[model samples]
Target: MRTWIRGLVLATLLLPAFPACGQGGDGTRPSPSIERPSVPSASRRLTLDEAQAWHGRHPRLLLAADDVAALRARRATQPYDRIAEMLLRRADEHMALAPADVGKAALAGPDPMPHVLQRLAMAGLLTGQRDYSRKAIAMLAALGEQGYPRRDRSVAGAGDLAVGLALAYDWTYEFMTAAEQRTIQRQLAALATEIEASMSPDGGTFGKLAAQEGMAGHHAVALGGGGLGLMALALRGEVNYLQSNAWQTTAEACLRAYYRDAFGSDGAGIEGFELTLRALGAALPCTIAMRRMDGVDLASATALGSVPAWAAYELLPGPSTLPAGESGGGLGSQDAMALMFAACPDNAAHAWLYDVTHGSRGRASFGRAAAGDASFAGPGAGDVMTLLAYPGERADAGPPALPLGKQFPSAGLAYFRSGWGDPAGDAVVAFRCLPRPHLGRWHLDVNQFTFHACGWGWAIDSGPGWEAADGEPTLTPTVGVAAHNLFQMDGREAAAPCGRTLAFVDDKAGWGLVVGDGSHAMGVTTFRRYLAVGKRDGRPRYVVVIDEIDPAPAGQAANGPQNPATAGEPPVHQYRHFLHTGAGNRVDLSGRVATLTTPDGGTGQFAVVSPPEATLKVAEIRTHAMGTHPRIEAQHATAGRFYFVAVLVPRAAGDERPIAVRPEGRPGPAIAFRVTADGVTDRVCVLTTPEARPPNGFGKARHRLQLSRGDLTQSLLFDLEEPGHDAPSAPDSAPGATPTPAP
Candidate 1:
């Protein structure tokens, strides 16, 4: 891909820091500007001649020169990357072609001008060559004349410029004549100015490299802009840079803030894949250049997990598995991570690089660059997955393979995924709760959870998708139950005028919190709910239950409401199912048994009996006041090879009652199971009476069966192992096999 740059932007640095927000106890604010460390003497500095010679000797850096020539000879018979292989092969061809006499019309297509110049400068500095410097300068001049196209506000602009300057200065500073050096500096000055203007007024630059939504965009913009901005100024003498504290303070403040907020403590970028690459790439160069100037180490604040390997680990698709997307063209998250790791394998970030690149999938495409086409030449068997498969190097340690997917749901009905490395291993729990969309009016999902993982997350909040139809923010997680799987009255997604997250707590080792109530609460409907995580003896388990008591049933109720200003209810309904996004064995939900349907159509019932507490009252009302659509979906599938999971809805002991079964037929006991294990489990029962006095007072009858369980394993007449159609007839008291009268 051609490196694109727009215009010779430039600007002076600004500074401002009043109240010292640092260790400088003196009243005045410390310089927010990053101080670049002085380079060791001239003998150690890389010269232009040295850099160029290094490139000529290292053929791999040219991507695939020999391969391209060979591919061209057999173009008709070779594959797509062969063509991309060829384009890269002759990058020198394009570089030598020369722009049609300076005044010519601006050429269209992916311009390789900036890339060629940058590459040449790197080569020149490494080899200490004069010719490379001259060639690179010529390309830079052409690039400046074209006036780079405007990029949607981005962090890349500043970062790229900073890198370009550093390389250029490092290689050519000593070799160039007085006139040449002046010209080069002038060009850099202009670029610096333009980047400064586009930088966010709050302190970073803005430019969209990928889709302009989600955590990815924000991370890219901040780190990209911050790193680049710091480099440009740090390289220029600090005395020549801004003296005001505000400008310096703002830049420094944002650099740390963005790195911390977006990247997280684990070094994981908030947005997945693409953005993580951009942020890390930009941050790396900036970190290097800044440290070269200043003594500060950003790595101390950022962790090892924040590197490209973290991204790669998440991207790997196990052997024989198709890539995650329905369409395979988009960059695989793992591939991007591998590439970045190869480019920047410093000791601090080496571990992640080694672990990811060593994975089985990564081994297949090591040392391979994007061939401008899908289905390119893959990696060697051993080198393919080696963390250092980038030809010239190798990362230590074998690649780490993470478990593709494993999930668990919380009490407030919030869902979470655990044991990324293995389905059975203990894992971090995050929230998955969303707000209702009322009459098309949008809001962020509340009661959302954020998982804390090994400095990296295999699964994360998908983040808000502004473009999504419901207008519910994706991936912006909050803590609490008001906006989760549990019920909320009058349909409030945000809960209150300015929703706030209530108190949340979890004993790190024992039970953990799935939801809380800190956010605002609205309307005439609300429930006090709690969930606990504990091991029944040694078996880990989660228990959840919600208690809702509606004092005034008179208020309007809707299935989902859209507008709050109005006085009506919205039409919202709740349903649960275990969704399958990938190819996996199917599970059947028939009567009280959940049977796993293998890849072939054969059936194996894994769980046994129990019915759920079904309340039609909660489903009947529809709110139109807020144009919100409220809904809940449950997705079920086989768990742990085989295990029977019986779910119950009857209130624990205290609320047992003889609940009426409607219309004469249906599973009546308040218990249900999503079995994924062997052995039979019995379904037990009890009953409950209305809370307040009914029409006939406390004696009024309502036949609701409270549920309980018994041993169903190793039983003959009631074997759960039998398919639903083959299972023995139920006892006369049970609903389906016997005659049961309606209330």
Candidate 2:
């Protein structure tokens, strides 16, 4: 885990508990409610009768004899050779280290004894070295004498120790003496019992409710699925049959719920990046163990099979992810990717992502592979799991199999890019409009967006929240609307029921658009945002954003908190459209244009072309956790209705092209704009209201857009009220215009 996550965990533990509130009709604060999927009958608990008849041979936890033999035979190959040498070197390093103090380990590092023992045991099995096996046994015996994990500490310590000890014991079962084996088995059983007890309703850190609803928190996987499951598998026939069966049954139930509810149908983790990686890492051990010991593939029955693709899409141009929800802004564990690849060997995109992120020893040309000054040489590199899970003689499939844009409807996330494979050249945009807040981890900035272009993240999300070191009651601004690139109404947080994606159109011709309704998120009558990405001559050119906001009727109840002074009078809302840039970048505001300059000399201009009365202000927002960053706010106040049109152009260094942006078309119910740069002129028109249809003959359309560049013109129409209504084909072209149907 990273330092930020550790801090978050500590802060979460210390924070005061808030009242359990329901969804408020006033839209000031709403509780998150996730509709969990029904558990499949096939995932039901196995009876004690069936478990007693089950038997497993030694070394069947993660590796069989054939697997080890094949690994040894293929040790001369590329990744295999590198991985084998890495494991052997790690074993040598462990030979000099002393057993961890379980009490101290629980508070900070957690028990390292299990990891050390696991590495030594695997090295022994691979090399047939008695010294490695002897060291592992000695460490196991030393740990057995101690109180493995102090009961007063966090349950995570117990969970980690269980996983590590179980793996080590199972791998080295044949090497230990009879008495030593008996002692280790007893310790493993005790660890399992402790973990199970921690999930009890009596005094458990994670209560029984968490076990039933796996997505209740991360503890379901860390404690119930991975730790408990692995320990039970290791002690199956060696311990009391009923005790082992009960542990396995509970572990399987938790895992089933976790795999089903924790992730969306598209495999996007609802809890965001950091927690997802942590959960996946914890779940991998038991997933592999079950597959090897019982011939059951839990991942195959759930969305785990699609996780790699979702992960691939979440990755931005650099090391960070989209940072849509709660995140620490780093590419987490590669071991999870290794395990996913082993289970899904034929997914080309997965292979490409794994190779680009972890194939090399140091940083790859595109993404970060290892930590600073860290080599893939020790147990810290996760050499054992990598060696076991990495597919032999596989080739990276690259980006040909991936689409230029994708939309995960279940997660309400859409990503569009200009191109692929080259981080420095591609222009990417991520838009999020989840139905509701996900376990308080997701921000209130629904319809939020992040943009990356010219090798720099210009518009970014504020990851995690501020935590005061002194334990003061500090505000977490990052989780509020001010920290995201979106529109905020009356400076209030979102308390609406949900945000909906009204329409999505991704064309193969290098232009895409996403329309989202965030009225509920902003607690307004109507709030829709239209974001479009355009490419000129097969290269990223510009992005255009159109925002429409309409306040609720005078007599109607607004979504957020209303002024008490006004009482029942019509409310006047102050709408602030926000845009954020990295702290290292410099922002200069001139009239309606905000020019951002990167440290590497890259430049991007955000020009507001509509609502001529809007004012632009640039300032630095300082937070305790994320430091200081530049923020651009387009302030506009209106009681009736309003809309905004902005164009963003990212230019590489030394590209001195004059860009022109201006409002287009006569006054109407829609916002129209044109952006011209580098001899390419792009025009966009967005219909703001569905009831008050525009006079341009766009009949009965709930959402309508017209995009034109050169001689290609595409018109998209969507009727959000009618589900699964196929959009009509485009009308015949007029002169130079070639109308293309909506996708």
Candidate 3:
């Protein structure tokens, strides 16, 4: 139990975070120290008759016999070449099963090595087999004689059994024996002395990798200190009981200060981009197997090797994803697209998201494989790093300059797309204003927003991956605030959000905008939210929301007009306004306008133009709704001063053109809209005033605010206001933001 690393912290390269001695829970704690027993001694590095006399040599360990003969001379039909034949048929059906009998898989569990026997002992010693390398060296000598089980010892659950028993005892060191490689090095030095007495003084880590508030400890320090620096770089060579440079310089200086306080540098995934692609499926394969076996360049650590093409060009062209906070699904992305093109294979947006979700068979993939730690859901045994760390390139499958608008201003996450990756759904608009003490799994969805067109999804936020459950994990309810969109008062909800984001416009060719204030997480005196997306009669494609609620000064009103000396304050709250659909939507509503119908067969329409005596309701979800599915709710309440607008149009059925919303001039976000379908008369504009500078053809040269079919002018930037959680740790900055931490 050595583990030091104080001087020249691994000769500099990002080290900082992992000092955390102890704090995150739920993984059953119990360790302050004590536990180390193993006895074995013998050596001849790589024996067994030199592994049958270097069998079919060519320095192959993690794929390389010409990279497995160019992946068995590929037949590239794409789906990333059939995920290289489903990772060599999941290491040939995990070397044809038959291993678990070590006291009967340790009587069902207690650290009996379960990541499918480290993918069939590294797919049977990288395909040479030998009884799957002596049954994974007899389950690492029966898990070091059952001593390495404090219930699978945690240090991020012993990073998949210490990186699959340090890659099956360093690629079957010449095929075992020498008392089977010293009985797997005395069970990896007694599981690295129970992970340095269970890390704490700041490194075995805790939580608050907060994206807005809490519950995300940078994927448990990327799978327990990145499986202790990829099992100390496969136990690089020998030494008195081995300590591989003090656990690779103290787990690369606590993952270079937890990738700048939890994976930042604007690649968003601050713990929400689906746990930032499932913690980069254990941080891009321990930062590409410690940069291809020990060069250790964390590719600028938090640059996170172009975060899966920055999550397929700013969070995959819509249609669901941003299950914020505790994250659950979609973007399960084929083991983070084979660990980011096998660690940046010249990346063309990670080979265009491995040609869009690996040749979709309606994406069900062997029925969610075994889910657990999502590296492209099992069955191919959790994407064996897309065929032993894919190097065989596809490089530029073309197209990637990406950005009609991009803003990760330190994970508050903002986006705007009209084209880039456009399959029609290029209008992938988004918003999440994250500010004040909000994250720790906060789904109190402050200034939420989402929209997709052409690429379908009209308006979504009913996140948490349709209530998870396929193989395991059924996490959908990101807790209360009714699965997101915003505004809920009397019934409570926004207890302490913080919300910011005031102006952003990428009106490059048409319109794209974002404006939010969420007035101190909804206590309300003026909680603005103006969202807009373009194209209407050039062929439907539209979205416009402009809620402006103000009612607090001793409030009172069912419809405005009579104040009578601020009469006995206190009873005028009720704000309700959430929008979640997809329980196979078919909604109808009417009076204030609703009209939806998707579930594959499309059609849309939404309306409710202001406090003209507000009204509208659709309701459904809430049997303890954790996230979504079973929602159609529209709601619009009025108890005092008012202003609210909603309009989403995609209307296709027989091209009937007639959409509406009107009430322009003074009321917070004074609104306007007018569409007349094919005959032409589009004038969609969501302009709120009392501005403070911002609105000059939406930034960057030559583009003016007046684009054709209207709908995208955008406004409301009260100097980007953000201060509530009452000093919830100072927020409100826009030129590359980042000042969070308040859950």
Best by lDDT: 2
- After superposition, which runs of candidate 2 have C-alpha atoms over 4 Å from their true positions? 1-38, 42-56, 73-75, 100-102, 109-117, 137-158, 198-219, 319-328, 360-381, 466-478, 496-498, 537-540, 551-575, 621-628, 664-670, 689-743
TM-score of candidate 2 versus the correct structure, residues matched by position:
0.78
TM-score of each: 0.49, 0.78, 0.34
TM accuracy, model 3 = 0.34
RMSD of each: 16.8, 10.8, 23.0
lDDT of 3: 0.49
Query: For residues 4-43, what per-residue lDDT tens digits would candidate 1 score against the true structure?
Result: 1111000101112112211132635432222211222111
Candidate 2 total steric clashes = 0
What range of 10 consecutive residues in model 3 has the weakest lDDT sum? 5-14
- CA RMSD (A), model 3: 23.0
Tens digit of lDDT per residue, candidate 3, span 145-206? 76544233456556545766666666555566667666666678667656644433333334
Q: Which tens-of-lDDT digit does each residue in 1-743 have in candidate 2?
A: 11100000000001111222234444455534444455654344445666555444577777776677776776787667766776677568778755654335433442245456667888888888888888777777676677675433456556666677787777777888888888877877887887777654443645354454433435344445567888888887778877887777666666666777666567777666556665666567887788776777766657776766777766666542334334644555544656666666687766666665565511431111332212111112356777777774345466646676788765678888766576556677888877544452556767888887777777877666653234565656467777778877787776643476656767545467777777666666656677877665445567777776667732233433567876564557787888877668889776667778888787777877666667788877665434567889888776666667777777766765545554544425565554544444444556644433333322344555565532223356432223332222321221112332211
Of the candidates shown, which would achieve the greatest TM-score relative to the real structure?
A: 2
For each candidate, what is the lDDT? 0.31, 0.61, 0.49
The residue-level lDDT of candidate 1 at 321 comes to 19
